[model samples]
Target: MQTRALRTGGFDLLVSGLLAACLLTLCGCTSDRAIAKKEKATHVVPVKTVAVETTQVQRSTLQPATVHAFYRAEIRAKASGFVKNLQADIGDYVEAGAKLAEIDVPEMLMQRQVIDKRIERLIAEEQRGQAGVRLAEARVRSAQALLAEASSQMAGAEASLAASQAEFDRTEDLVERGSLQNRMLDESRMKRDSEAARRDAMASSIESAKAEVAVAEAQVVAAQAASDAAQAETEIERSQRQEMDALLDYATLRAPFAGVVTQRNLEPGDLVRQSNEVGRGQPLFVISQVDRVRVRIAVPEAEAALVNPGDEVTLTFPSFSAAQPIVAAVTRTSGSLDPSTRTMLVEVELDNQDGKLLPGMFGQASIHLDSKVAAQTLPSRAIRFDEEGNGYVYVVGEDETIARADITTGLDDGNSIEVLSGIEPGQRVVGPHLKRFSDGQKVAVLPN
Candidate 1:
């Protein structure tokens, strides 16, 4: 009986120990389950919702620029004088040949009047010279008449002498033959000698008349030369008068072109001089043609190749919010690149027929490049660079969680950036952040 009892006690002890072990194992399992439930409830995962939609992505460049008038002119006074009247003021629209200002050029007008008087006097003098020439011609005619009369008298005297010499020769022969008396021979000789003397006297008179004719001819030639000289002087004086008259007319300033007067420098009664420093040509008015305007933009050299003539661009002026964006065409470009800024100069032309655009206005230019392969565009803030300069984004996963993704990027057009690869359309991207946000972090998006 004692042996049986000992065996039973041992069995009881073993059973009790087995029951305790089973209870401990169940309690341990319960504790483990509770801990796991608490941990699962506390862990928060990052999430961002995404929707798929089509969006246009444009790769463009922004350039600062200014508006300029295509045609500009500085109106100046061409003649030196005191300003008499100013017809136009700044901001006045004027047509071509419109009078802008008038100068009081009394001195010039008086000079012209004097020149005119001189011209008239020269004309009278020329007429007098012509009369003198006529008088000299009449004297030449008189001298010719006298020379002809003297020639006729000389011929008569020569004939009479020849007759007398013949008679003398006959009388001398008769006397030698004793049929003629000495007195007859002497009378014949004396008559011949007197006729000869008269002939010689007539020849001398003809020579004197010829000399007088030569003197009269010389006088005529001299008078004609004087008349020609006087005529030339008259022409020169007339030309001078005309030139002075033109100068007087130029005293009135007129618009050089059809444009708006941008500036006015002088007022009425202001004295103007020829030297610009002395306020001569001091831009009595400034005119500019605003029908067409120019915008000069400096584009970075890296992208300058894409900018060329004929390219369309959009511009915005800061002053007016309601103003519509102006569309302009690239008219030309500065072929050389600026070394300081590494930029090229580009000029764009825009129509401004309404005169709404003004020169020297600041603006911005947007130039679109050729279309590239469809790329994913994200808000510029979505991209973050690590310490090594590698860009990445936080992408939402299927379980409403976040995953960090690496992406390659291209041009950033202010608001958005082009995702060349590693991103897709409709992907959720973070907006600009005030502080750095980690990947996989949960975020609540504000209502748009």
Candidate 2:
């Protein structure tokens, strides 16, 4: 009976083992099916995407800048003189050629007076010479008249002698033929001789008159030459006076261009000498044009290659307003870098027509070294961080799956960030709603 009970218990144990094995197998199959169904339920999600492409970026470099006047000139005394009065004071705005100061040059005034007096004397001498020329002309006319009268007298005397000679010839022929009286012949002969002597005397008078006329004409020529010399002297004197006047005009200092007076060196009664070289002597005034100013900057040697003319630049005046920046363009640049400073000089022109910006104002300039550069970039928001804090972005894979791609970030220009590595241009990246995507998640890339 105990042996029969042991067999029955053993059979029951066998059946329990079979049931436990079958239950364990069924549970394992059910768990695997549930996991497979859950994974299969993850459908292709509709997500926005953008192509990874190159974009233009602007890069800037900051440097110190100095503000200077567009044009600066030292108003100096051109003539040795004293400052008689200051027409313009420091900070006064003056136009080009406007008088800045009046100088009192006693010697200059005296020299002008002397020139004036000399001119008057020369003019008077010219007038006297003209009168002398007229007097000489009158003498020539008188001599000509006297010579004509002498010629007339000689002609009359010759005619009378010819008549008397004819009478004498007729009377002598009558006397020889004894038909006329001898006394008549003698009277005709005497009359003919008297007429001949008068003709000779009249001829001599004509020669004398001609000589006198020639002398008078020579005197007239001399007088005319003297007159011309006097006139030329007058012209010379006038030219000299004009020169002196020009020098005298220089005594009044004038603005070389429209600008503000930055400095004043002379007061009333200050003796100022002529200043030719700058920084050598005190100037009466210093004028600088503030309507337009030059913003000068020194670019480092490393960045000099990026600077060029016509490139836009920004300037900020720390002494004036730091927030408000003045926008201008690079007007010029020194082609060669400075050996000592190892920097290249750049200049920007700024208009200050409102007279707000002053010369010598301190400022800073930002040069857009690379104004616009095309490079591989992405929107800042598109970048993501992985669990390990690595920079990455979600990309659309070839199989229409979300791929976590690692990328190296470069310059961030507020609008976009540069991708230096691990991503190629023209590749599609998940756009907005990137959080909806997970690793290996199937997705439908929407049109951008």
Candidate 3:
């Protein structure tokens, strides 16, 4: 029993020893944790910083562009006819007024011939009527001369009749007084009767001449009317001929301006309908002036306001990558946006004297919109973003304390970012690992 009691006492002592060791170990671990906390409070984090600088910053956008001719035209037929001769073909260069094709219009030719014949006949008829008018005028003059002659004869006959009557009266008075013979009185009476008959005949002749003059004048007016009608008919035929000539001119298709033929739709002998006709065929030719080329771009509304005439543009053709890009200035821009597309139309003109640029070619255009000569900027690594997408930077103060500052960014070129606000030139900001630093934390700036 004594032995069992001693073993129990020894087991109690072992337990007590273990308890002391455990308590001491716990105290040491607690002391080490306090020391670590103190060291952390006094520690200074080392960081790399960059100075904010004022430099030139440029903003640009790239958009798809298409090359177009300075002037383009689709030449269509104005007169329906079968193609007879093709003077121009695809890729042919032509000057202004150069004939491109000729059309064979048999019906038009027949109509023109008929008009010519009709005009000739009308002209002849007009001349015949004019001759008749001249003849009528001559007859009028003859009739007037006859009337004048008759009037003179009538006056002479009347004078004679008056003298004869006086003689007869004197003779009769002498006979009654036994101074003259009855035969003498009878002779005077006979002479007076003959003069009166001559005067009456002359008066009748004057009336007949006046009636002839009236008839001649009426004939002259009628002849003149017929001549005027014939002349009017001739003029109407002439006007029809002029209209036919105009229509015939359309059979010869000529170039409206100097250009290269880009397309040819009809061959010789092909029937082409007039452009104004229903169910018209394709155009005869498409001409494009390529001495100068236009690069057209549709700029989105977001950047449309930044685009303007005289701005520089760089054109790169994907199809011709090895070819050097063309540099030109913006020629113009549509001030308003397209309602359907919501994009602004912009154009750039390039001199293509070498004939390298062609219509329908596509490329990309890089346009410089805005530039700042002296803008505050920070390295891209120095900028950080919050959960709301707002950008901030860790600014290192003179006392080496870090401060969080919100900044407005303007343009970024991958390496550097333009700081429009909340920063100044010569200010230092943390370069990278921005999350490692906090507001009011002390830091040691590393040497550049």
Candidate 4:
């Protein structure tokens, strides 16, 4: 019993010594943990930072519009006529100046034929006048020859009269002196009287020849005048024929432009009058050019300032096919807004190289009202919402401390938000660790 009491007392003393050593070790570990936490608290908070930058952003709006052809016309008659042939029908594609229909104007045709016949008659008359002129010239030559013969005869008669008178005087003197007989004297006197009569006749013939020449020359003048009149008449007839031919050419109705014939109301053997007349007349054909089309979109008044000429656009033809939209640009616009609808008319031109677009269709145009507008931007992660749902961002100042900058946002493209006011560009902003940052807290910025 004495030996057992001694061993038990020794085991109890070892247990007490082990408990004291453990307590000492636990105290030292607690003291070290306190010092480590104090050092960490003194260290600055590390944060990712970004700079506010100016960049471009686009805002868009869509408007309803109608598709129209670049050119459209209602072909109508310019002159009264009967439709002789119907060459084109609705939905037929026609080229420029292609014949669409024909008219039969028998009156105009007959008048043209009459003018041609009149012209031929005038030509024949002119030829006859020319022949008459030749005949007149021949008569003038004959008269000249006759005048020459009459002058020779007059000269001969005068010489004979002179000789006869001389002989009569000698014979009378001889008879008085008894040197010549009375019969001889009487014979000489008779010869002289006969010569004198012949001379007077020749003189009359010369005058007649001269009068004939004058008449012939006057006839030549008259004939030439007639020929000139005929030539003038021919010119007049030619002009009349030209006018008649122009009227007859109105017989055929042709296309004014390359287009599709949309309407055809006249047929063969139908009496069609001029469309511009007092009575209500139907158009022979309605044609529309569709190779390219125009879409007039109405832009709202609110976005008028953002739209301008040469802006890119997207056109969707919902009525035709919505799968593929046509891309084009704003070609023009109505500078003034509509008072009733308060919308401005904007026009877009689209190319239809594949012939998919047509006139008289409904479409939608997406217009880039504004794009690439310069603004202060921040990363989307930097924006924070307060209790009132107002947006803000953390901006680090020159002292390495953050401050809450309340900004009015313009556009949010999911990656960045536009800062309309309260923040300038090139300023330092807290990027992702925005929420953890408190106002006026010091932060260590990491290189971007």
The candidate maximizing lDDT is 3
Model 2 lDDT per residue over 1-448, tens place:
9999999999999999999999999999999999998887665678777777788877777899998999999877779877787789898999999998898988988988998998899889889999999999999999999999999999999999999989888899999999988888889899999999999999999999999999999989999999999989988988988998999999989999999999998888888888778778666789999999888899999889989998888788877673577788899999989999999999998888988888888878888876577878888778887788678888888888878888988765656778899888888888756354668888887776
Off by over 4 Å in 2: 1-53, 57-65, 168-178, 276-279, 296-316, 319-324, 328-349, 362-373, 377-423, 426-448
lDDT of 4 by residue, 71-179 (tens): 8888877768878788899999999999999988887888888899999999999999999999999999999899999999999999999999898888999999999
Q: Spell out the clash pairs found in candidate 4.
A: none
Q: After superposition, how far is residue 149 of candidate 2 from its true place, in Å?
A: 1.8
For all candidates in order, the CA lDDT equals 0.81, 0.87, 0.89, 0.85
Better of 1 and 4 by TM-score: 1
| lDDT, candidate 1, 236-351, per-residue tens | 99888878877776887888788889989898889986544544445667898888888899999889988878777889999765898877778899988999989999998888
Q: In candidate 4, residue 433 scores what lDDT?
A: 69
lDDT of 4: 0.85
Stretches of candidate 3 exceeding 4 Å from the true structure: 1-51, 56-64, 154-208, 277-281, 299-336, 364-374, 377-406, 410-418, 428-448
Prediction 3 TM-score vs. true:
0.68
Query: Among these predicted structures, which one has the highest TM-score?
Result: 3
Q: Write one digit per residue (lDDT tens) for candidate 3, span 22-140.
A: 99999999999999988986799988899889777777778999999999988888789899999999999999989999998889989989989998998888888889899999999
Q: In model 2, how many backbone clashes occur?
A: 0
| Model 2 score (lDDT) | 0.87
Looking at candidate 3, the ten consecutive residues that score lowest on lDDT are 274-283
